[model samples]
Structure formats: structure tokens, C-alpha cells
Target: MLTEAEKAATLWIQTGFTDRTVIQAAVAEPLLAGQSVVGVAPTGSGKTLAYGIPALSRLVPGAGLQLVIIVPAQELAIQIRDVLTPLAKTLGLGFQGLIGSANRERQVKKLREKPEAVVATLGRFVDLLEERKVVLEEVKTLIVDEFDSFEPDALRDILSFRRGGLPKQANLGLFSATDNPTIVSEFQAAWPDLQVINETSTDNSRGVVHHLLLDRQQAGKIQVLENLAREKHQRVFVFFNHKHVLQKVASELRFKHVPASMLVTDGRQVQRAEALQDFRSGRVPLLLTTDVAARGLDVADVTAVVNFELPDTLTTYIHRTGRTGRQGANGTVYNLGDDHDLRDLRKLVGDRVALETEPGEKKAYRKSAAHSAGADETRGVERQTGAGHRPGKRLTSAEEEAASAKKRKKKKQRWRNKKNVGKHW
Candidate 1:
């Protein structure tokens, strides 16, 4: 007889239309059978289902919420919700989303009702725990998605929930696409006998083609962007280091007549959702964003990725570029950088990325900008501007002292003449 997990896996395969071998294996033999498990797989590797299938399979129908998935961002929570919600419905399981910027009152009410599963962000989950609005006593399985992204404070808050008490034999699963050596080592040290599943080396090389373009200046970047936009005509994701830069890039693209939208951390939930939908539907040709959209977003049909500014970490770079080349599709990543960035690019991707030279015209200095032969254009008027005519001229120290002395002498002479006039009076 097939086990409950097997039954769920079969249903998932039919509904989702892909066979996840590792996920199936994990479900067949759960990590909590005496040990913890950490799965390191790249984006679009069906990680959510890897943990979700086993979690939902373990749930008893009509029981209280027993599973919780903690993600890094609210957008990711929603993405996971969208994917797992269908499976939950198919299996007749109830789930609730506990992310930020949602109806907190409704979430509190739902917690009282006790759904079968809860997907949430770390901060909001901590808030709920502090408010006593949600109890984790019934949670037998906890999945922390993108564990590498969790800061020390958030991790402490997560551990604090145990202060209230935890399940006797609760299972913990940590999943991430990029592996941070320190974080992975720390986690392993904490749980000495944890099982690690690595599927990155095999999966990363099979699908994507990475390209690194060495652009000397902003003009070169704009030129490359325009070329790619016209050629691909597919959903493009452009990443920047700052939110303001994302906004600026989006605005500049729009000004250049490129249909672009932005996704940043400061936007409202509905606004982010609408922007994502617009990009996914091909209504927006370019999607400008920061690292907020780098991880856990499952936008289909992203054809190319442009790194307007490279991220500081290798994990960030991988996740940013992972937006494209999904699901065995032939996608391209263009890294736009100046000469100073080439060394970092080489260290991150090695020789895997093809190096392309900037155009000659792009490298050549502009003749128009060089000092023209005759008069200079000043506020649309011709002026004989030169080094002498330029503002901020400074006097020598000696010249300054002599001018002061002359003024002092003239003042003294005027006072003496005034005294003589007084004597004559």
C-alpha cells in the first residue's frame, strides 16, 4: 500500500506536472526521523514542494495548523502561497498567509480558527508570537525558506518561540538556493548530524548561459540595455543596489520610450503585485528592482537579466541572475560594469561568463565636449571664456596684505584731516 506522502506526491506530480526526485526522496524519508535536513538547490528547483509535500502529507485532516513556512519577504510568501494553495485545495487542506501589510485583525481571527498551515515572514511571525495571537505548540514541522538570508536577530527571535515551549519532536528544514559557508557551518555546528542535500553543481550548469559585459560608462550601459530590449523583446529583469537607483533607472527607461516598471521594498502589497503581474504578462518589457526581487520570486518567462549594479555578495549575484534562464530555458545574464568591476566579476563567475568588448564609439572621447576652437557657449550665449574669466579667482597672500595696508593708511589720513578741521573750528 502506498503511504500518505506517496499519495500526495502522486497528486502533486499530476497537478504540477514535474517529478522532483530529491523532494520525493525527502518525503519518503523525512528528516525528523532522528535528524535535521538542509536542502541546497537553485531557484525554480521546486524547493517549496520539496518541503511542502512532506509537511502537508504529515498533517491529519481537519486538525489544527501543524506546518509553518518562514520566508524572507512578503512577496516570496505570496509566491509560495500561490504555488502551494492549489495543492492545499486539491488535498482539502486549509492554509493562511501571515505576511506584513495584510489585515492583522483577520490574521488574528484566522489564527484562532487554526488553519492546517501558515506561511509568513520572520518579523511578522515574531510579532504574532509576542502578541500571543498565534501559538506554535501544534506546529510539528517548521520550514525556514532562504535561511541564508536570515540575520542573527531574526534567528534569535525564531529560537525565542521555543521559550513558550515547542513540540516534543518537531522537525526543522532549512532550504536555500545559494550556500553561505559561514551560515551553513553555523547551522551544521548547531545541529551536528543534519543531512545536507546539494543539487546546485548539477543543476546550475545545465540550463543557463551567463554573459559579462564590461561597460566603461553609463552611456555604454544604456546602449547595451537598448540593444537587449529590442532584440529579446521578452520579460527583462534589471537589478540595482539601491531602491532610488531602481526608481531612477525605471524613470530613465520610460523616458527613453521603454515600457518599464519597478518593484522595490517600499511599495504597498497591491502595487508590488500589480507590477509583478504586469511584467509576467509581457505588458512591461523591463522590470527594474533592487535585491528585494532577487530571491524567491517565481516569475515565468524572464528572458534576460541585466545587472545595472553588481551586488556585494556572490549569493546576491546568483539570485539576481537566476531570475532569467528558468526551467531549462535558454536565458542570458548581462553584467554591466566599469573597469574597476571586472576583477569582482571574474572572481564571482570565473571564465564561465563571456567577456564582450565595448564599441569603439563608446570608448572614444566626445569631440564636442573637448574645448572648442573659438568662443564658448555659456547659457546659450557666446563668451570668450578662459582660465582668467572663470569664477573663484584668488589673490596672493602678499597682494592681500598690501591692499589691507593701503586701506589702513587712507583711513588714518582721513582721521588726521578731520582732527585738523576741528582745531581750525
Candidate 2:
């Protein structure tokens, strides 16, 4: 008999996932045997198909909520739903996305319809559990995408698990582009039989060129960006560490008449969804977003990733760059740096990132930038190349604790005042 991955890939026929990667193949072995799995793989290496195909092959027809997929963000939930829904249809399965920003009454109506699979943000899923609109006892498998960022304590509110009625031997699939030791250790301690898989790659950054531009107090960052956008005329994802900065950069891009928008994680689901749609459809070619877009965002044909400011963590740096050069496509990554960023840059990307005075044109120094006379309007001057090595050490102590604590507090607050959490009616 053909294995589950083989069977599904064969049926996929260049539809969902034509070929499986190393981690995808490795993850299949255990899922075929109905075992729990946790994995770490490079971003954009087909991580979705790595888990989706196996989970789909195991979908239970007419089984209420047989599969529960928990994601870290509403955008990711919708994106995954979009990717898996078509594949599910190819196999005659039904799935629903239950996110925070959508109508609950409609979702309750869909609940009446009993979708075999559900993609949900952890908070919204807990909300449904509290309202008794869904039963987790029917869930045979729980897949946590972006598990690294998913709060481990969110599992404490799961109706079935909390009530000691969790579906018998329920399987788990925890996956992410980066690994969180705290999250993984907790999961392993809870499920001693779980299988673990991690892939560390230096070449995943291959086919990508890295460039560094020095900004003295970010004086010329926006102008440098505008020049690139006008010359390249392609989609670019610019990352800012702060929400306010993201808004400011996005506004500057728009004022400069660059087709641009911003992505805010905590923003309303409807609004954020629309912005992403506009960017994806090429209605806008530039998106200014925070680190939330650093991982699990699968925007197609991004020509470059601009780090308006580099993130503090190396794993985040890797994921930010991972946004481009995806699936073997060539891309350029622009990193803005300064005197303070030099030591950190050397530690993260090392010699692979080439330093430059600026890209395209070097004009007479001015308070406001203007294209140099005799400069190529194409602005295709210097092209330098570089590659990255490995993930940085564990994040700062405060950051680690804060992320976990915030997740727990959010989960707790969502359920504390809600009645019927322990009732079925």
C-alpha cells in the first residue's frame, strides 16, 4: 500500500504540493502511524504542505470537528484556510475558518453545518469552546502552526482536555520555522510519546543577495526606500520594529505616491485582510509591516525585503529575509544599519552581507535627497551578495517570559467571565 504522503501527493497531481521537502517527508512517517509530531523547518520550505497533506489524508468524514488547527494570528488562520480548503475539496472535505474579527452568528450557523476541519486563532477557538458551539472531544488531531509563538498555556482552556474528555489518544502536530525550547519541552512533557524533528539549514538563504545601507539616525531611510521602489517597481515588504514606525513609513510611501500599505497584527481582521488582499493583488506594491509578517506570510513574487530596522533576534532576522528568495526564487534583502548594528550584523549574517554607501545613486550631499545628475534612471549601480549562517542565541530573558505570560493572560481573560465553559447547552 502507498504511504499517506505518496498517496496524497499522487492525487495532488501538481495541485496542492507537487513535491515534499526533507521535513515534509520526515513528518509523514509518524502521521501515517497515527502518532503525534513536533517539527522545526526553514521558512518557505513548504511547511504548510508538510503538515497539511498528512492531516488531510487522515480527515474524518462527517466527524464533527475532527481536526482543529490553531494559528498564532487571524491572518495566518485565513491564509492556511485558503491554502487547505481547495485541497480539502479535491478530496471532498469541508473546513471553516473561525477568526476573531468575523461574525460569530455566521460561524455558529456553520457550526450547525459541522465542518470536518476548523482553522482558528487560539483566542477565537477558546471563545467557541466557552460558548459550547463546538466540541473538542471529536477532534482527533490538533495542529499548531507557528507553534513557536503559540502560547503553551492556551491548551489549558481546551474544552476536552480541561474536562478530561479529550478525544482518545488525540494526536498533535506542532510546527514552526523557528524552535522554542520552552514550548517544545512543555509539549514533550505532556505527551511523552511524541516524535520530534528539527531541520537547521544555512543554504536555505541561498539564491538571496543581502545589502546593507547605513543610516545616520534614519535620516535617509525613506528616500533610500523611495528610490528603490521607483526603480524596481516590484512588491517589497518593509519591516519596522514598532507599530508607530510602521505607520509613519507606510504614510511616507503613500505620500511619495508609491503604491503602499501597512499591516498591523492587532488591527481589525476585516481591515488587515483588505490590506493584504490589496497588496497580494498588485493593487499595492509596497507593504510596511511589523515583525508579525516576518514568518508564516506566504505573499508571492516579493522582489525584495527591506528591514527599515533590523530585528534584535537572529531567528527573526532569518525569517524576515526568508520572506523573499522563497521556493528557489531570486531576491534581494536590504538591511538598514548603523554604528551600533555593526557587531550584531557580523554575528548574524556575517560576511555574506555587503556594506554599501547607498544603492543606485550617490548624489551631492543634501538635507533632502535628489537623484544625482548623470545617474541612471534605472538606478542599477552596485550589486553585492551575501549569505547567512545560523540562528542567534536565545532571546533576552525579559522577552521570553513576556511572550509566554502575555499568551496566558490573554487566554485567561477571554474565558474568565464567560459562562457555560463547563456546560453543554
Candidate 3:
């Protein structure tokens, strides 16, 4: 029951994105009829093709740049361009992969040439807009991919583009696998008439991901990741919250002959190119990165994702693990963090985390992760005691009085509750 254009669209997909809900929903009249779309679909669910096909199909070649795609990271921009550029060339449509590290002068020259589409990192795109006379007057569609993970810099560039010379009538689309309620609220408030399309799997996770936790310190976590990389084959994305930690982990891995590379926002172009080449070609087996690679970065046979540190929020956790277990394929994710991280994860996702407690040596690992759910009250008490306390100084007059009063009040409240329970018993 495919229309001619739909059939043509499906024919262009080399990645076998033929039977996805996103593709169907995107091509429907509503989306093509200028209804701004907020597509919340699972990772590896053909989200790129869902929007890309329709966007490309609407392209009138040589009509000055018609489509503008904004991605959060440089690598994402490069990856999307890799997917769309060939298809564009096939259709006689021109597009440019605009990146900051790449030749900006050449990119400007391409902008002057007015490619039919521009897949750009938010920072580079903004810089180009300032330095060059790029025309957005002919732009008809605007796409912000990975909306949740957009950094402050990217968001700033997007706000400027939204309020700047770009036509108000341009079709707008915001897409990501992770749904941030705050961002969703903001988008809805901004575009009251936007059509919100959610095809995210009933269970947010796609593959048979093992929601696991490794209760280890920072050094121990690196060792665990190394063990995973050496044991099971294929690429592994080891994520750290801090860049310093990421680099340190990578250095340790390399120092121990584990061939680890750092993939971060500020990584050099040559390094990025080599890292991707090695990853795709199986030359480099392990990549240490920050949240930069969390969303929409595709590498074949990335069977697992390792969280060197548990992400701060549930949204981040979902996306980080969503990297693996994509497209109904089986994958695994191992999260490493302290007791609080494990507890918070249990609270947020419930039993979605299938913490693996293997035989032999992993018995203790299982025990370490056992009390995650029940440790909440204890953790809370620890936080109150250790938070913001100076190492070698007594509390000031005001602080001493406040601390004593607070402790007294807490003690009294606990005794009262305990007495009440005793009376009932």
C-alpha cells in the first residue's frame, strides 16, 4: 500500500529502514502539510529516514538551500551528512556537512554555492551566519536533531536562528529518543500548533540491554570496562561525565595496551576521522567519550555501551544505553557508579535494570548492587552530615545554632514517630 513517492523514498534507504513507524508517520499528509513535528521515537528506529526522506523529497534542486538540519555535536553532524549526502547526490540534490574543525573557508564556499541542504553543527552554523552572507530566505524546513542533549551553546545558536532571518513559515521539527519534559514544555509553548508525534517504544529500551551496575570506584570502573572490551568483541562506547575523567580513563587504557581513544566535542578533526575509521573498520575497539556521542551516533556492531559513570538524570541514562540494543538488535549496557546512582536508577526505572549477577567471581558484584533500593534512607542521612561541612573549622555562631536546632528537631520527630508506632503495636 505504498504510494509512488513513498516507494521511491523506501528505495533510497540503504540501511533497511523500510518498516518503521517513524517513516510512515513522517510521510503522512499532516507532517508534509507543514505541521511542525516533535518526533519521539526510539534510537535505531529509522528516525533519520523518517524525517530525511520527506525533507529530501521536497527539495527542489538549484532552488537555493531549502533544508537546514541542526545537530548537537560535530560527530553527529558528520554522521548525518554521511547518510544524507550520498542520497542527495543520487537525487541530484546538493548538501554540505558544515563542521567547525573542517575547512570553514571551503564550507563558506559551499554555502556560496547554495547547497540544497546543510547539515551543520549548531556552533559552526552560527559562526558561518555571522561571517558570511548565507541566505536562509529560501529555507523551507528546519530540523533540530537530538533536542534534549543540546548544550547551552547549541541552544543559543538555535534561538538566534529561530528569531533571525529564517522564514517564520519554515516547517519546524524537533526530534530525539529521550523526552525531557522541560524541553517538551518549552517547544509546546513556543509552537502551540505543532503536531507532537510519539512512536517511542512502550518500553523505552529497544534491544535486550542488560541494565547492569558495577559497584566500583573510578579506577576499578576503568578495569571493568577494559575487561568488557577484551572479553566480548565489537565496539564499546565508554562514557564519563567529565572530560578529565574521560581522558584519564583513555590514557590508562592505552597505557595498559587497550587501544582506547578519546572522542569528545573538542577532539581534533584528524583524531575524530581516525577514531571513526578505526571504530567502523574494527581497528580501534574502545572509545572513551563524554555525553557527546550519546544520541544518534551509529557504528555497526556496537553490541554494548559502558557507562563509566552513571548519568545524572534518567533521561540521560536512557539515551546513553539506548546507543546499544538499537533496531530490535540485541545489545547490553553496563552502568558503573556509587550506591546513590544505583538507588536513583532503581527508583526511576524500577526493575528495568536486569542487573546481572553471574557465577564464580561476580557473586560479590551482585551483593554490592543488592542494597541499592534500600540504601536510600542511609544515603540521605550521610548527605545531611557530610554536605558543605568545612574540614578543620567549627561552625560559625549562626551555623552552630542552626545545626544544633536542626538535629534536635530531627531527633524529636523520629522519637515521636517511633513512639506512635510502638503505641499502635
Candidate 4:
């Protein structure tokens, strides 16, 4: 049932991926048939190729702008352009990237040439559209990658063109790793016949990933990172929750002569590009970044991902860890935090990924009654801390309680003595 174009496109990409991912299988035929689809697949499940192949199949060389792929970040725009450029070339189609922090004059010059496809950041694309440098009337397919991450106003402005909207026949494709009901509903209302596919439930593309917990205080974070950098064959992505913290960590790592690069979403485009390039080429083993900057990155063979700080939400954790273990490759996720941070992380991820102790770690996270039943089934040994406990000794619940009571009594007595000495009994 494949169209001639679709058949040719599929054959061309087969050499890259051994098997079709769930998202690819579910979306290829429908998209090629010009059906609007909203695909929700796990991160690293090959969403780019799933959408790219079909989009290319429908392109006509020298046919003006027929496809517009909108992404959240500038880096992501460039990444997608790099990914699909060769495929587009094989089909005699022209593809170019339009992003912020790059040369607009150059992009406009390329636009003048009538490229068939464009991967663009929303803001930059809108600027061009407003300036009348690009037109959407001929655009047959519009793909919004990481749809949930886009701001509604910017997206609405682009979709509801000032001159007019996209051609009525233009089909849409929205893709993301996580789902936002509000965004989905808004999009669904715009296209009543939108085929919503939830492949996360059935998508099993993840590889053997080990989620490790490294217990370290805030002060020891730099030392831990320095040690991780020396590990052989480790292409690590160090994630941070805040910009200030990421900056501080990056400064410290650089001072320590650790060959780690930092990537910030708001930084200079050339610097960000260079950092990613160095990391990808293995000239550097560590790349420090925030979730926003690294969202939807498709870097290969990321041996490990270290959380210098705990992620803010479960979705963030999933995206961060999903960077590794891509395409059935073995990877590790190291979480560097204190006991309190570890507890918060355990609660955030819940029973989704088991948090195991680092090898040779004598003390590991102890499961409390508040943890889910599945979380208690950890392979690591339980950790205990209280007064009168030996370095490597285990204590029963009752014994631990007794020790706590004794410590509280001693502390109360000391406080009373200090108050009496001050004549405040």
C-alpha cells in the first residue's frame, strides 16, 4: 500500500536503522497518506526518523516551501536539519535550518532559493513570515516537534497565519516524549480528525540502562565529577536544575582541569555548537547542561548521564536519563546527591526506575514505608544511621528507635543545664 515515493524513502533509510521503531511503524503510513497525527513515544524511540522519512517522501523538488518543522530550541532546529539534510538531498529536495543567534541575512538568501523543507525555531520562523520572506500556502506538511514545550501564543501566531492559515489540505504532525492534556486538547480542537497515537505504553525501544545513586553532599559534587571524568569510554551528560548552579559547577570543573564542556540554551550559538561538537567528537568526555538546552538531543553512545542536582520533575528525570541507553545501547545514569536529595528523587521517579547504590558503596538508600511497594525491591543493601551504631552494623527498627530516644533525652538534658546556668529554668 506504499506510494512510490514512500517506498523509495523507506528503502533509503533502512540502512540506518535495523528495525522500525514503534512510532515509525505507527506513523509512516498515515503521514504518507496525508493524515494529521499526534505521536507520543518514549524519548530516544527514533521520533525524528519516524516523521522525517514520510515528510521527505511527500516532498517535490523545486516545489517551493512544502514542509516546515518547528522545534523549541535553536540547537534542536539545527540538529533536525543535520539529520534530514542527506535524506532530502537524495530525494532532490533542498532543506535548510532557520534559527535564532545565526545569520538572518544568510537564511533569507537561502529562502530566496525556494528550499522545499525548513527546520526552524518558532521565533525565527515567525520573524521571516512577518517580513514576507516566506509563505505557507504551499506547505503540505507542518511538524511541531516537542509540541508540549512550545508557548501557545507563538505557536498560534505561526499556525494562524497573518495573511491566511496553511492550505486546508496541509496535514499536521505533533510529536513529544511526554503528553500535556491541555495542549493536546487545544491541538485536537483545531483538527477534529487528528489521529492521536500513544505509543509510550507499547514502545519498548529502551536499552539496558542502569540507574545509579551516588551519595554526595553539595560540597563534594566537584570532586565526584572530577572522578567521573577520568573514567574510560564515558561520554557523560551532567545535568543541572538551575543556571547559577550549572555555571558554578562548570567554573569549578574547568578550574580543576576536567575536560568538560558547558551548554546553556541562552548562550552564544557558536559556543554552544562548539561545546556539543567537542563532546560528540569525544574530544571532551563531559557535557554540562540544563534540561531545556539538551531537550530532544539525539547524541549517540552517551555512556552515562549524571544528575549533579536532582531534576525538578519525573518528566525531567525521564528526559535526562533517556539521553543514554539510546538505540538498545547499554548506558548508566549516576545520581549525585545527599540523602535528602536522593529521597526526593526516589519520590519523583517512584517505581519507574530502580535507584541502586554505586558499586563499593557501603551505605545505600533505605526504603521507608512511604515508598511504593515496588521501590522496596532494590538490589542494594539498606542503609541505617543512628547513635551507638558501628561503622558497618545493621540495627533493627526497635533498636534504632531506642537509640533515637536516648539521643533526644541527652540533648534535652544538655539544653536544660544551659538554660539553668543562665537563670532561665
- The candidate that wins on lDDT is 4
TM-score quality measure for candidate 2: 0.78
**lDDT (Cα atoms) of all candidates against the true structure:** 0.66, 0.67, 0.66, 0.76
* Top candidate when judged by TM-score against the true structure: 4
TM-score of 3: 0.78
Model 4, 68-166: lDDT tens digits are: 999988888889998889888877789999998899999899888899999998888888988889898899999999887777797676557523658
Task: Give the lowest summed-lDDT range of ten residues in model 1.
Answer: 379-388
Score candidate 4 by lDDT. 0.76
Going through the candidates in the order shown, the clash numbers are: 0, 1, 0, 0
lDDT of 1 by residue, 1-425 (tens): 55665756665775665555444355336542434678887777677877777677777657776888999888899888887777776667788899988988888987776778889998788898778777778878778898888888887766565556557566778888877677666655545666777777666423544453444355445544554555445788888898877776666666666677788877888988899889888888778887765468878877778888877777887787777777777666667766558557767766544433322212222245432321133211211211011222222233343453355346744311432211110
Whole-model lDDT, candidate 1?
0.66
Candidate no. 4 TM-score: 0.82
lDDT of 1 at 265: 79
Cα error, candidate 2, residue 331 (Å): 1.8
Candidate 1 residues lying further than 4 Å off, grouped into runs, are 21-28, 31-35, 188-192, 351-425
Q: Which stretches of candidate 2 lie over 4 Å from their true place?
A: 1-7, 14-17, 151-164, 202-206, 211-213, 347-425
